[model samples]
Target: MKRRSNLLTIGMLALLVYFLLPLFWLVVASTKSTGDLFSSFGLWFTADFHLFQNIGQVFTYGDGVYGRWLLNTLFYSVVSAGGAAFLCALGGYGFAKFRFRGNSTLFGVVLAAVMVPTTALAIPTYLLFSKIDLVNTPWAIILPSLVSPFGLYLMRIYAQDAIDDSMIEAGRIDGASEMGIFFKIVLRSLAPGIVTVLLFTLVATWNNYFLPLIMLNDPELYPITVGLAAWSSQTAGGGGSTGDLLALVVTGSMLSIVPLIAAFLLLQRYWQSGLSAGGVKG
Candidate 1:
């Protein structure tokens, strides 16, 4: 048993290192100057620490365009995630509790949609949006992001167990309207599941790259992911200022992940409970 425990510990340590190594490297690299990046070992800091300078350059470059991308990302992610979570909760709750015509068929369709890749739908979605004259707008990104088949599925599974039919019936007995019951009673019961879907959609929309890249032609509409990729492409194209741009990209990359990390840390308990409860119920 002691030997098995030792092996488990080693395995856990290895997994920790595997996940955190890149983040560690990013922190180290972000502190180094462009020249120090290449000259010094990647995992360690050097004499020249330009962390703040690199961050300043990241914001000030191209007349503070990175800050604009940051704001765009925040808007797209928050709006999309919040909307998607609410919609998913509504759909999932209905599917879980209500009896309607063609209910099984519609639920099956949602299940099928969960299997379809978003990348496969991107071009078709773009074309549809173009016809509606919504292309190259924030809606181009936000509208598409609001549809999350996986999140719907997750919420459905969670709602099945998290909410009780008797409780809902009791709310109705108390003269609560459908929407009122959902807002006051059902929502409180589904808090963990809602949070789980919110975090999933939030992260997906935050790191989204290809959809925005293909949909938005305006740089002002670019998210941090695409803006950083653009800077990376410039660095690869080989200019005399490539080094400075490279450092800015590194620092920006590190800064971009901070919000995601904080989100995970803050909502981890709810996320864990949601997943575990859903798994057990499913």
Candidate 2:
């Protein structure tokens, strides 16, 4: 038993190091100038402290375009994630509580959609959006992101476990409308699932790169991820060697993940509880 315990402890510690090492490197790299970044040992601080300088450059570069990109990211993430969560909740609640024709078949389709990679659909989506004149607009990003099959599945499972049919029936007996019961009671109970979907959708939209890159042509309309990638690309083939855009790219990458980290930290308790409840019940 002691030997097994010792081995497990060592294994856990190794896993911790494996995950933390890259983050440590990114932090250390962001604090150094480009020269120091290339020359110095990774995962350790250098004598020069350039984190603030790099971040400032990131925002001010190209006439403060980074700030615009950050705002665009915030807009896209909030709108898409919020809409997706609501839709997921509605779909999940309906699937969990009500019966309709071909319900299981429809859910199976959703599961199949989940298995399909979004990247594979990007071109078809682009063509469709172009026909509708939505390409190169914020809708191009927000609209596609608003449909999350995984979120619907998660909410379906969560609703099944969290809400009781008896309560819903009682609400109906009291002459409450279905929407009224959902809004007043089911919604409150679905809080954890909603937050879980929100976080997932938020992260997905915020870090989305390929879709926006394909959809939006205007640099001003770019999200942080795409903007950072553009800056990162400037270093290719010795093109942006005259500027600190590469350093700015690294620092910006570090800053870009802050919101995601903060969100997870704030909602972790609810997220964990929701998953546990859903798992145990279903």
Candidate 3:
């Protein structure tokens, strides 16, 4: 038993290092000047530290275009994640508690959708949005992100066990309207599930690249993912100024992940509880 435990411990430590090594490298690389990036060892910092300078360049480049991209990301992620979570909670609650025609069939369709990759739907979604003249607009990103089949499925499973039929019945007995019951009672109960879904959608939208690339041609409207990619492409092309842009890209990449890390840290408890509850119920 002790031998087995030691092996497991060693395995877990290796996995941890594997996951964190790149992040460690990113932190180390961000502190180096672009020239030192290639000259110095990747895993360690050099004599000169340029993290602050790189960050300033990231924001000041192209007249603070990176700041615009950062704001766009925040807007898109927050709006889309919040809307998707709410819609998922509503749809999930309906599927879980209400009896309706085609309930099973519709839910099965949603389950099937969960298996379908969002990338596959991107072109079709873009075509549909083009017909509606939403192409190149923020809606092109926000609207599509608001629909999460997986979040709906998660909320359905969570709501099934998170909410009790008797509490809903009691609310209805008191003449609470459907919307009132949802907002006043059901939503409160769905907090953990909602936060879980919110975090999922938030990260997805924040990291989204291809969709925004296809949807928006305007650089000002780009998210951090797309914006950093643009900078990376510039670096790839190789010029006298490539080193500067490369440093900006690395620093920007590090800065972009900060919010996601903060979000996971802040919501870790709720996320864990939601997963635990879902696991138990499943």
Candidate 4:
């Protein structure tokens, strides 16, 4: 038993370091100058402490471009996540509760789409959107963000266990319309599932780099991920005077992840409760 406890402690420590190592490096890098980044050790702080200055430079660079990118990220993540959650709830509830023509086939298609990654569809999506003039627009991101096969699957599973057919029948017997029952009764019970889907969609949309890279050419339209990547690229040889901008890039990257962290913390309880409850029910 003592040996097993030691092994468990070691395992937990290893997992902790594995998760926190990158974040630790990121925090250390954000406070460094470009020269210090190259000369000093990767994990430790250098003699020069430039965190605040680097943060200022990040926002001020390119005439406050990082701020615009941050706002763009906020907008995209919030709208996309909310819309995705709503759609997921509607679809999941329908699939879980209602019997319709081709329902299984349609759900199966969604599951199949889940197997095909979004990255694989990027170029094709870009071409399709380009033809429709949706390229370089927020719609390019927003429209695609609304469709989450995984979110739908999660909600469908949760709705099944969370809401019993007896409950639906009870509502219907009370002369409630299907939509009315959904809004009043179903919404209250599906809270955890909705939060789970919202958090998933929020993170996915927040950190999306590849999709926006192809969809948007305008810097104003670029989300934080794409904007920071563009900055990071400038430090390469022959990439221009961006060698001095490395600190800003690192700091900007750090800043960009703050909202995501806050979001996870805020929604974490709901996420855990919902997932664990769903797991037990399943």
lDDT of 1 by residue, 198-238 (tens): 99999999999999999998999999999999999999998
Off by over 4 Å in 1: 269-282
Taking the tens digit of each residue's C-alpha lDDT, what string does model 3 give over 1-282? 999999999999999999999999999989988888989899998879899999888899989999999999999999999999999999999999999999999999999999999889989999999999999999999999999999999999988988989999999999999999999999977989999899999999999988998899999899999989998998899887666898888889999999999988998888677678768866
Q: Which candidate is the best by TM-score?
A: 3
Q: In order, what lDDT does every prediction score?
A: 0.92, 0.91, 0.93, 0.91
| TM-score (C-alpha, index-matched) for candidate 1 | 0.93
Q: Where does candidate 3 stray beyond 4 Å? A: 272-282
Model 2 lDDT per residue over 108-140, tens place? 999999999989989999999999999999999
| TM value for model 4 | 0.93
Worst 10 residues of 1 by lDDT: 273-282
Off by over 4 Å in 4: 238-240, 272-282
> How much lDDT does candidate 4 score?
0.91
How close is every model to the real structure, measured as TM-score? 0.93, 0.94, 0.95, 0.93
Cα lDDT of model 4 by residue, 1-282, tens digit: 999999999999999999999999999999999889999999999889989989988888899999999999999999999999999999999999999999999999999999999999999999999999999999999999999999999999989889978889999999999999999999877988999899999999998999999999999999999998887777765355676788888889888889989988988888678678778867
